[model samples]
Target: MDWAKDGRDWPNNEHSRFVACRPHRWHVQAAGEGPVLLLLHGAGGATQSFRDLLPLLARRFTVVAPDLPGQGFTSLGTRQRCGLAPMAEDIARLCEENGWRPHHIVGHSAGGAIALQLALHWPVKSVVCLNGALGTFEGLAGWLFPVLAKLLAMNPLVPRLFARLSSTEKRVSDLLASTGSQIDPRGVGLYRRLVADRAHVEGTLLMMAQWRVEGLMSRLDRISAPVLFLTAENDRSVPPATSVLAAAKVQDGEIVELPGLGHLAHEEAPERVAEEILAFIDRIETKKPPKVSGGS
Candidate 1:
């Protein structure tokens, strides 16, 4: 996406910055001050996905939200790195280079998988997943979805064709509705801008084609950080049972259901989501052994 044209009215525009992290130039937005909290949006979404949630979380923590490589304002270097493991590794390096040690991670959908992958190596205190796409497709979908995505990604003309077809306001609204979420006009507008851009569309397709969740699911027990799977009852994109089953595998995982909400639960009700996150973090802190001072 063109920052000059498309990002003119971007949410939290003042906090946005471009950082060259080798192989990719990342666009990250940081605000407030305290322990770092990294916010990762799902595939096809940008930093704007956290426009409301970021400020609320920033009230108590240093919040950092970045557009994944090849999506949003971030330019992609290696197209193949859009996969789960590589994305996590690249993000870890990005954080280390920028001196941002995330005390906690809050990821939406596919971002949730990346968060778990990061926790495998990074020492984050906790992780929160909002309507995470934690499970693979069942039966025929499991075999067909990735294959179809790969074929689409391989076609150079597909992105432009998709962007053209999906650029209308009605189309964007329909797409969001398909997720069983009803967002405001502003939210719809942002998504429209994304779909209007061929690069964003291509990047999203590439990520979808390369994404693999089985590896992460198999190693959930290895993650030491406490994880909270915030599932939305009305979510049509990913069933709430996905989180229910995935949480059972984590050594320190818990599941919370958001009633009457959908796949984009955070966007639908940022305040409520923030409350759950803050409450979860508080619980984690309270469980920690208190610090002891040495005698002078």
Candidate 2:
């Protein structure tokens, strides 16, 4: 009943509204009251992924949870490129529309890359990433598997296989179930419902096709925002060390490790994740990072 495409089950989420951006009617779930905190989910997720952690983060800052284009209820454009730039652009638009100025962005996995890109390009005050991949780094063979996943994603054969996934309902459920044992009933259903459409299939595959973020790693130094790199002990999805490396590059970055949590640290360990984000926000509001003048 909750998984229906129609707006029958949405009101229960609270701070609910319908915002039309283009191809789809984006379902927004806004709650709490404070500074802006835009939460971005990974490739295979919707706003539902942030269910457990949103309320906590919302305590210290307002949360704008919008399903990315083609991931949740949002739709893709006529001719779209599903990479970091476009995704970040869309997020910027969302922030602007919701009056979420001077916000902070938190991204996970693909969302993490998008968050980094957003931090570089969008008007955000700060950014924090959890278990994200910088698979675009040059000569980083250790992440060869993820890099190869990005490469193989562009193959013509992939769209065919990915497109067919939506036709069968059981396949979708099984895919989401593979993530964790005691999956959230609501989350499992949402994940299944989201990928059941062909357009969603196209949007997802396009992201896979355009999976190239490492090209912008060098430009990260240009990003002056304070970033927090939070990773789990041993995340199989996005290498934890990859995050550590990126953190070291940021002039004023802080890194925190949550022991024994999985790739989805926000959900696996929401309280700890919330605490770190709250601390990061306090740091940013205090003062700007150190700067070198043009006369140097």
Model 2: ten consecutive residues of lowest lDDT: 136-145
Backbone clashes under 3 angstroms, per model: 0, 1
lDDT of each: 0.87, 0.67
Show pairs that collide, candidate 2. Answer: 136-214
Q: How does candidate 1 score on lDDT?
A: 0.87
- Evaluated against the true structure, the overall lDDT of model 2 is 0.67
TM-score for all predictions?
Answer: 0.93, 0.78
> Tens digits of per-residue lDDT for model 2 on 1-296?
12354446542366656687654457677888977788888775667778788888877777888777765566666436467787677767777776877488888777888888888876678888876766642222234324434645556454345546543556654554333223455655665655555555556656665667776688778778888887776466566678878887776666777776656677666788888777667768886443232101
Q: Least accurate stretch of 10 residues (summed lDDT) in model 1?
A: 287-296
In model 2, which runs have C-alpha deviations exceeding 4 angstroms?
A: 1-12, 22-25, 136-186, 286-296
Report how far residue 98 has shifted in candidate 2, in Å. Answer: 3.5
What C-alpha lDDT, on a 0 to 100 scale, does residue 291 get in candidate 1? 20
lDDT tens digits by residue: candidate 1, 102-204:
9999999989888889999888999998888787643333454476476785777888887998789998888788788899999999999998998888888
Among all candidates shown, the one with the greatest lDDT: 1
